[model samples]
Target: MKIVKSVLILILFLGIGATAWFYYPHYQIHKMKNDSMEVGKDLSRETYLDYYRQYSKQDIHHLAIGDSIIHGFGVDETENLVYKFSNQLGHEINKTVHYTNKGKNGMTSTGLNEMIKAGLLDEAIKTSDIITVNIGGNDVLKTAKKQDYYGAVKSFDTLQETFTKNLTEISMKIKEINPRATIVLLELYNPLPADHQFSDLADSLLPKWNVNIYEVAQQIPSSIVVQTTKVINSDNPQNLSQDGVHPNSAGYTAITTQILKQFSKEYRKEAV
Candidate 1:
């Protein structure tokens, strides 16, 4: 009877551990979403742009590079985040925001690092006043769908290590090329629907992946990490395209707003 009681106790402990394992990620996600919503609340866009007007040039050269998000895949040329961001920013600051996009479909963090090292983006990086990076979605998606949860988690751990290294190298290299340019790194958002099979796994891992992105931004000068999880998640299915991976025009607009808000907040911090 003592042995039976011991076995039951062990089972109960294992159940509790399993519950915590799943519940903790969801808790992190909730906290992150709340924090994202609070960002830039003290500063308005008008105020931020007014501050920019004081220090920015009459013409702004914007360079966007990364995967399909940067490339404006699954959306019209005018509807992409880059276009929306430049247009709105230019109008607000009264500057000519000329942009050159080097976004390629299916680009990964490793590929971006290789390109920067190979000097493929030298001229663009050097001449740009602003640069936005949106790579890593492909990296996350590549490992998030494994059939075994443990296997997927292991793969993501390996991927995160490589991704962090690559992102750090990429940001440092870009800063080396253009010390004055502001680098905006977009945080990866979970694209899986809440009801999807891998949704829980994605929720479990996305916060960690985004943490790496944030850490790299902190280490690099003139770098900003823009949070997109609040605006681009499974809850907003209408924002996504039919493919369910890429954002539609509306989704791009939401992302562009987040970028502008975060950029302006950074500006406010410096001005204050």
Candidate 2:
């Protein structure tokens, strides 16, 4: 009995030590990223000026909104989806299109709706010919990550309801601002690979969140949902950045391809 108790105590201490060793650095990195790297609620005055200013210079405009993926968090402007999407789209349309990114890191669906209410996207939305919104990832992820497996799924219903209402408002607001423009809402992708610790949670939760997005898209005219499942999983080595969450250049490329395909399909339908 004494030997068994001693062994158990030693195991507990070793387990705790291992856990702290692994988790402490991760915690610090998360804290640092939260503090220094990401652009938060304050959309800079310069970015605003540039957005509206570019509108006057171009006949076509593409505005991006939502989270870090849309913002191209770690990557440069050239490698970001918004930039690449605009360039490639411009080629197909045979016209120059200026792109504006209003995507902030860590933005949620409710945050997007609030930003619209705050008039952050007023003039840009009013002038944009194309608007691409990538939202809801953080919203569901934040909620899902907190709960156990079974509980996490059950919690989705409440979030889906709120997400539906918030997303519908966002779409409606965009339509009110520019009734003629095309809107593309990108679907949420599971960034965790099967090998990842969080893969099971992320894989199960993301699709449920995307279903709400697609259903909302169906309600809005001149809107479409682009498939992004191919890019979000870490199994696709080209898909993720160093962080393994946000899209890398190749992942952005894949997303842009899908968006452009959707745009082309919509354009043909409209032309008919």
- Give RMSD to native, each candidate: 4.2, 15.0
> What TM-score would candidate 1 get against the native?
0.82
Q: For each candidate, what TM-score against the reference?
A: 0.82, 0.72
The 10-residue segment with the lowest total lDDT in model 1: 263-272
The candidate scoring highest on TM-score is 1
Q: Residue-wise lDDT of candidate 1 within 180-239, one digit each (tens)? A: 777888888887789998788788778777877776765665666777887889889888
Which parts of model 2 have CA positions greater than 4 angstroms off?
A: 1-58, 144-154, 197-201, 266-272
Error of 1 at 137 (Å): 1.3
What residue pairs clash in candidate 2, if any at all? Answer: none
lDDT of 1: 0.80
